[model samples]
Target: MVAGEPFRMLVDPLATGHCDQWLDLPETSRAGDAAALLDLLFGTDDTLDLVVLRVGTVRHGTASRRLLRGGAKGIDDAAGQTLPGHPRYELIDWRCPVCQTLVWRIHADPRRPPECPEGCGPMGMRRTG
Candidate 1:
């Protein structure tokens, strides 16, 4: 690497650069990272066992599932306890089976998943956390 060398910017924000959208641009930053947001799970969707934890992050981007952490007593259980008295914030997770594409967001009733950029058809819900 050298000074003034071109590089990749992970997320698109109030930013102008070559965006390396290897992952989807983050929707919110102050809303908290995925783990912190897990508090939304409790009492919202009891059937949802999905959990996501952040192993690392930069630029509010990077959605690699391989880097995710927390589950069961880790992120999952803690979610129910943390943010005491906080109301539910329904979230959802969708994955593209063919390309391993992943995404998550605040969910609305009966909204369908977005089409895969890889042209793999509609992504399916893996779960929510």
Candidate 2:
């Protein structure tokens, strides 16, 4: 998937949260470029409270379904240890650049950051309170 293409993201919150959130790919980067996507999402953080369940282009809902199935297979392969819900794991919180929405807390370990729930694009690191 390329940048600007509609993509869905499946995410699980840090603490006792279930269900997946579908979001578009950030305008600034392409989906095939995992590094750029990760940087856009996570910023400088190395860890994240939310875990990426799956990411894929949106085309007649087939891509998302395929990704979901793959994610499920991965979970099964992990011996059911990598379930969607996990306990609280704190990370630095960031605010959305456009809407000022509080984004998910992220760890110092690099990973994909959460997009704005408002569909504003990938969130940037909040510089101030």
The CA lDDT of each predicted structure is: 0.39, 0.37
TM-score of 1: 0.34
Model 2 is weakest, by summed lDDT over 10 consecutive residues, at 57-66
Query: Per-residue alpha-carbon lDDT of model 2 for 1-129, expressed as tens digits?
Result: 343232223222222343222223323333333222333334333343333323333211212222333343322332223222223223355667787666434243245766666678887765544
- Candidate with top lDDT is 1
Candidate 1 lDDT, 2-112, residue by residue in tens: 211111211112333322222222333322334444344423435433333221133343322222232322344333444543444445566777887655555542445
- Candidates' RMSD to native: 11.4, 10.9
Question: How many residue pairs of model 2 clash at the backbone?
Answer: 11
The deviation in Å at residue 109 for candidate 2 is: 7.1
- Model 2 misplaced regions, further than 4 Å: 1-88, 106-110, 127-129
Model 2 Cα displacement at 121 (Å)? 0.2
User: Where does model 1 exceed 4 Å of error?
Assistant: 1-86
Full-model lDDT, candidate 2: 0.37
